[model samples]
Target chain A: MENLDEKFNETIKMGLEIVKETEEDRLMTLSVGPQHPGSGHFRFTIKVDGDYIVYCDPDPGYVHRGEEKMCEYRNYIQNIPHLERPVIHDSTNITYSYSLAVEELTNIQVPLRGQYIRALASELNRQVYTLYWLGIYGIFLGHSTMFMWPLGDRELFIDLLEALTGARVTHAFNIPGGVRNDMPEGFKDRCLRQVAYFEKRLVEYEDIFYNNPLFRQRTEGVGILTKEDAIKLGVTGSVLRASGIPFDVRKAEPYDIYNEIDFKVQYMKTGDSFARSMVPFLDMRESCQIIRTLLDKMPQSGEVRAKLQPNPKGPAGESYKRVESGRGALGYYIVSDGTPKPYRVKLSVGSFRNILALPYLLIGSKLADMPSIYWSLNYWPVEADR
Target chain B: MSSNQSNTQNGSEQKEKVSESVQTSLSKKTETITLEFESSIVNHLVTRFTDKVVQVVYVRPGRTKILVPPNEIVQVATFLKDTLKFDHAESVSGTDYPKDNQIEVIYHLSSYSDEKLSSHVLALSTRVDRNDSRMPTLIDVFKSTEYHERETFEMLGVYFEGHPRNERFLLPEDWADIPPLRKEFRIKGR
Candidate 1:
């Protein structure tokens, strides 16, 4: 008993020294920001008093290239490549909303095959985006193995996407009318095989990362958000779902082929870091099911692209469209005055809304819990700033 | 004296019957109220506050738009939050109309508590003066409008009265040009 007590005291001392408290008079202010590895291109000034965050001020816009302002200068088609640059990894979904909004504005009809292919690309991109976020989330928690596995597996999806769209990273596939082109020969069989293989690897991830006791101890019950607070604060996507509110834009407002596709909205009631992590993990599993179904139901052959004039202009009106991107609900609002270029374009992304809860969640929590909470919110800085 | 006692007893019985009838009518009234509001969100807004809501248009199947005057925006937002259960504001966007010399601000409100209302989007819009763009803030009604209100203020220069912080959110500290979304502020060489 004496030896056990001594060992326990040693563990306690090590934990205390890890998160050192400052002097009462000396409150430390930290800029976890533009230069920091944890924070992306964004910067947030946090004032810590004795290892507890007293105040936090998030400073976004380090990567803002004035995408909305630039949209007014380019015609409809030229804007696709430029718009996809903001969130390059999640390029398909970003352009997907723009295409849907533009389609409503211009009154263009997409072929059924085109719509199915668009949904397929969206599901594939969703996996890539989530995997990229998971990789970053892993590294933030000092789990290097978790970081490498997702990135290494990510290459498989990228290779498949490259075959479909002829580009690996930024596939400027979805235009205003439809996708740039159709699927290549034998693409369906290759896609199904790769997706099925990826699904098997997901089980391995469960064994190594999620089921590990260390990972669970660090994440569970940390940075909890109540259901009332979640809805009152206007958070969307997985963060809201984690709080037990099943408000997925895909389930609530079905765009494209989401209504026809059979799948479930993965959610959790814990509203903590663990819940946030699990929601995306389950979502990746569901994406596999969606991709398989989309492949099976897709039309064999049809016109993928609707031919338009050199520059496509719309009627004098406005349209608002939103899609469930990897981060959250991505909405595009476009106003046109019967001109080739849009009069005003507003891109409301999920990262910005999700980040609003940071200061609320950060205050009074231990500084050690910062990375677990921040990254689990699935914030992408470039996308937020854009 | 005996006749007076009989009259008092009869009066008490009549009072109990009237109270019971009132209870039944009250429940019926509430049932109609819920059905009326639930029948169509657009119709509820149109009938509840006819004067404040200028013109209600059904933009699409899931979207219902209501155009309100700038001053009455607060009133409309409050009614939507309290009477109806539209709990959250999704997006707050401002459009610069240089040709008409006005700027339009639109707020997309949806509900989370009410499952039926969750599927729909209520777009509340109001026009403000272009040069002196000022409108009452809806953050008090819906807390989620806080960040969006700041974005609109910085982007289109539409000053939201009574917002806690109207400072630069997405822009640089030394941004000196006119609001970037305005029509007069042209991009370089555009």
Candidate 2:
């Protein structure tokens, strides 16, 4: 009778301990949501112990539009406008890859002058995209001035793109055969002048943003992605370059006169948020030189667009083409079944690959460093979700 | 500059023509194709997976396609990652071949550490049973392939075995329609 009574008391004590553990919570869950300022069209659930984040789960796809599925419905050329919408700010480069893929499937060749012009617009769009990314990165880390300057400076390129392509953001300039049109009359002199002034503006950016002690303290050593971790996780663009890899798709797989144009691949070994931010800055400087060279070396006059059938189709085959966009290597895989519409169109975006590094980089880091680490990966939520 | 050669399947000839024209106009630099050396990496892969690979073709410049049986994909991927040092997967793409009643999953693997391998993109593909579409995941061999496998899971409904998280990523939680990327999943009002 005494033993039975003791067993009952022990069971009650165990129940009480379970209740106590539930009442005294150690980790707090925070849902950085779809509408949050720091998180862009995406949500992530992070478990925090005080200020330190213990766990993180990135919830992407708030903007999934079934782009691959939709590609089947539209003919090849008609899909350009919708495809570019994923990363509309970096529209040219995204369309550049698509055009290259479509060209491969349909066996269309982009002219020498057309290739140079395409590369020029791509470089210009890179500047626009990077500047916009820098602005958002700045605001994410609570620096108002850094945010304002890049946004204002971005207009210089946007104005140039508007003149060259007519549309500011969604240029729809890249087509399967070649670019839609050639460089506008007297575009060279204006582009050069603005590019030179932009070089001076870059110095101002370095002075205010890169060298700022407060910004450095928050980003310099925080969120360090080692060389091995970076390659293993397959982070691309600035994130991979920041981790000390000199694998730029432009130099690695030169397409559309990238090999002909001379420029150094900008990379850094530090692999921190600061390094991630600085590589794009250095790339902007390199892009200015590339633009000048492209202008100087471009053919005097030639055909820009190759004439194609109303509905271009080719033999059954598959082709994949990649371009070095503002964010790493953006690739398009096209499968043609001798039809006007594609059998399949798979867009392998850099934003999607780069965003995979989040959970690895975010865990065990301070909650305050979340925005700094997240934005440093150069992940565009809309592109990634697509 | 406009030539009938432009519409040929392998546009390398046109690319060369364009390169030559650029050189002639500039009269400053020599235009040379740097991909000659990178093709050897594909040669090495062929030698390694001779019996395993059902077909191997240089689909285009800097792009190689290797087709293998679904059962042998993991083995071939291990050889590429460990021996050939194709460090990371660039992309995982799926093509639904309804006529054949199979789903082709292609893993585009490349390297950042090895300069030669870095320049080459190897498209390793295998066709799995459409009705019972399942294949072993390569996440263990290449960490970068985790999310891509998850994407293939929801998009084409290819079940990647051994993947930790195979839940819906881009689709809604309550979505029960057939995977949208399949050949027959037609968009409404098209």
Per TM-score, the best of the predicted structures is: 2
Name the best candidate (by DockQ): 2
lDDT of 2 at B54: 38
lDDT of each: 0.86, 0.86
Q: Report the Cα lDDT for residue A253, model 1.
A: 80
Residue-level lDDT of model 2, residues A218-298, one tens digit each, is 999999999999999988999999999998999998887888888999999999988998999999999999999999999
TM-score of chain A of each: 0.93, 0.96
For model 1, how does the per-residue alpha-carbon lDDT over A301-375 read when each residue is reduced to its tens digit?
Answer: 998878787878877878888999998899898989999999889898889888888898888888999999999
Q: Could you tell me how far off, in angstroms, the CA of residue A306 lies in candidate 2 after the best superposition? A: 1.2
Residue range B81-182, candidate 2, lDDT tens digits: 888889998899899999999999999888998997676788999999999999999999999998899999999999998899988888888888999899
Candidate 1 chain A: 10-residue stretch with minimal lDDT: A18-27
